[model samples]
Target: MQKVTFKIRRFDGEKSWLQEYQFPYHPGKTILWALSYIKDSIDPTLTFTASCRHAVCGACAVRVNGQATLACETLLDKMLDRWKTDTLLIEPLQNFEVIRDLVVDWEAKVERLAEVKPWLIPRDEFSKETGCRQTPEDFKKINKNSDCILCGCCASECNKLSSNDRDFLGECLRFCVSGK
Candidate 1:
């Protein structure tokens, strides 16, 4: 068995704390798995998110080191190694608000998404007229990013947030609204 440590941030609105956990590592053991082990064995009070553990769900996204990533898909030892120099920071994404440990208040982000109208304008109008065609070539262009689980990984990495600017809609929003 291998041991890896997670130096995570704990916050409850006004208060903040930091803690580390050493966990047993197995092949393909992801950050989510380690966290689940900690939650189940060490501290049941620890809070995080996980649904389909297979990365189908975006709920498990969190910061590893300084970059946002899906906890379920992030390799434990590798991520630990990546953050070994500094604290393996884990916090809720920025640009919104925090709900609890590793979770954010995304209500506003959802609201903004709703504001985009999401290509529905063409949908209703096109349906009333003749059929509109789309080719596989168009689909393949951004097919990978299209699978974005709303993880907010790309959003957290942008420098605009630290700079405190609201102009940038962030990558996730761009991915959703832009066709190309």
Candidate 2:
């Protein structure tokens, strides 16, 4: 087994700091697995969000080597191979307030989505059994947009929102709004 070093930016409300962790490299392991190992074995106080480990849920989003991505979707071997280093740097997503280590507040996005009326409001009255109907062609129009898991990756990478500016509605919300 090889040794890998992970440098993580940790936040605890009042302040934030960088913390280093060491892990035994295993082929084909994802970044999420390494993070889990760190939290479970190395530091019990560490915190992050993860759900639907298969990537369907967007809860495990974090910045890896300065790129916004999902931890579960990022393979450790691939990242090391691509970056040509045994060290990985992880931090909370950009344009968000960190609530804790690697966990950012999603309330802003939720609020924006609420403002946009993200779901369809049927004009015509319909029964519970009749449900809303849509043609195949109509369904296809929003199919791609519907794939968004609201992971905030697009928002984190957006040029419109830097650390200084975060009042703008993110791409994820725009996509969801358009899908309606």
Candidate 3:
């Protein structure tokens, strides 16, 4: 395709609308790059959050065609191929308050997470001075859970949260505290 089109859902605190933008398509470009290109070259008013472009930081997570994915790691070509279209619908993650165009508010989520007491209470064997050391096997058990970057993807895709957000803590926070 010569060009790719993006229909992005934009919110400015009170009002919400869909804004369309098109740009020349390039091979091996990621969704994050496309967002950056639009913001930098096309529309300076566009708002989104991204950091640690390596995908370790989940700040770049967004709903691409109704599914939550890390924008930095998702290739535009892959999305185009998967959907068999040149146009993509981008929206803020579901089950969160939208702060701006594509940015969601984390303040409430953080507050809810704190209610779970996600931290561990140290045993008498482990103290601040000596520090706690765990065996490789112990670390391995919680390794996968520790990888959660709080990107809100799991929460966004969670059916339970969509239905009853007040009761459900969402998968990400559950997994995070479960590991601890």
Best by lDDT: 3
The lDDT for every candidate, in the order shown, is: 0.70, 0.86, 0.90
The per-candidate count of clashes, in order, stands at 0, 0, 0
Off by over 4 Å in 3: 174-180
Between 2 and 3, whose lDDT is larger?
3
State in Å the error of residue 14, model 2. Answer: 0.9
Error of 3 at 109 (Å): 1.4
1 or 3, greater by lDDT = 3
Task: Sort the predicted structures by lDDT, highest score first.
Answer: 3, 2, 1
29-137: candidate 1 lDDT, tens digit per residue: 7878888998998878778878998887788888877678889988876875665642356777766577777777777677767766544234443653566555699
What tens digits encode model 3's per-residue C-alpha lDDT throughout 14-132? Answer: 99999999999999999999999999999999999999999888899999999999999999999999999999999999999899999999998898888887666567899778898
TM-score of each: 0.77, 0.91, 0.92
Q: Residue 47 in model 2: shift from native, Å?
A: 0.5
Question: Candidate 2 vs candidate 3: which has greater TM-score?
Answer: 3
